[model samples]
Target: MKKYNCIWVLLCCLACVGTTSCSDKKSSADEQEKGVTTVLPDTKNEVTTQILKKRTFAHELVSNGKVNARSKADLRFETGEVIARIYVKNGDRVHKGQKLAELDKFRLEQKLSQAEDALLKA
Candidate 1:
């Protein structure tokens, strides 16, 4: 019984080795016939080339919403001053140095007077 078991184990090992060698040989022969060479890919320094061909892609953007500006800005005053008046409304075209809103100067004038009195005392 031990002799039969050893024979079966040897046959299984031989069968696996034989199949692996035969497959390797056949694959190498097939690659040679197709002029294919095995090359290790350099994933770190891989260079890819692409042809710049013009492709027309038609995409219909169907919606009830309007396409607004690509960029939007929320303008505000740097100081925490009260806004007395606003010259421009929403979606208004404004230029640089344009007055957008007026600051409430009554409180600002009182603060300035206090600061000046402190400076005079010092």
Candidate 2:
């Protein structure tokens, strides 16, 4: 009876070892079949193209007070006459050589006539 008990214990231990080893073998086989590996490929030989081009970007800004430019100046009429007609309002975008406002033509002609008379008298 003692020998039979020892044999039974040995068989139980062998059975547990066999089951664990089979599971480990199955997992290793699965990993091999799936091509799962920890090694990474080298990326040092990759080439990329970068083209240089012009791009335009726009942004909006909000302010409470009046904004002034560093080189801004007030435009005044040389003859000190009232404005006859305004082509643009305040804060309107204008370009170089663009007509913004026009002076009274009659007033300008009168000034020109006065200048001419003065020159004639001189």
Candidate 3:
């Protein structure tokens, strides 16, 4: 009875697999008979031609993002003073000990003169 049950299960599995494969083949044959077609563009007639010339081309990229420096230095004056002149703009390359901007010379001179007068009185 156990052997008979195993044989029945095996036959059922074989029938399922055979039916699935036959259904797939039938659907594929029907699709082929429908004859789906695709139209390709005519390459010869639609071809674009350009004369090659030796010229310099500049590529510019516009983007919206924050750029960070590899090494950054926070610049500040030791004393609070108005800026007299600026020698460089933003994103300009700078070297070590380069003078980026100058303090107001006239105001600095006045401070020095006042300090000298106070020292003399003391």
Candidate 4:
């Protein structure tokens, strides 16, 4: 234990002494360099011209699309009637202009039925 303590004290003394000596040498060098540092500000004060140019680039692409059957139903509406005929339920396959809903046209079909019945009776 006594040996370890002697080594620790020796290291601390050596570190402090080395650092103090280095700082003294650096301070003397800094004093000598101060004369040259003063001239740097005067040299920087003179303006020097530098040229810069702007550049631009444009890019484009070609595309094509089909032009056919341009008809469209912006707003589709049903008459003020109940859904009498629904050939398809929810989640059913559909194509263009497929019959999806029918109003309460029972009376209209019945009228045709009556006309056919009269023709049979005759």
Q: Say which candidate scores most in lDDT.
A: 3
lDDT of 4 by residue, 6-114 (tens): 9999999999999987775777788888767543444546688989767675668878996564454443445455667768764455697888777788766887899
Global lDDT of each candidate? 0.87, 0.84, 0.90, 0.74
User: What are the candidates' C-alpha RMSDs?
Assistant: 18.6, 12.6, 8.5, 16.0
Q: What C-alpha lDDT, on a 0 to 100 scale, does residue 23 get in candidate 4? A: 72
Candidate order, TM-score descending:
1, 3, 2, 4
Would you give me the overall lDDT of model 3?
0.90
Off by over 4 Å in 4: 1-71, 74-94
Candidate 4 C-alpha RMSD relative to the actual structure: 16.0
Model 3 lDDT per residue over 50-84, tens place? 99999998989998999887887788999999998
Q: Which stretches of candidate 3 lie over 4 Å from their true place?
A: 1-67
For every model shown, what is its TM-score relative to the native structure?
0.43, 0.34, 0.42, 0.25
- Over 17-114, each residue of candidate 1 has an lDDT whose tens digit, in order, gives 99977774676677777986689976787699999888998989977977687678877777898899999987788899999889999998999999
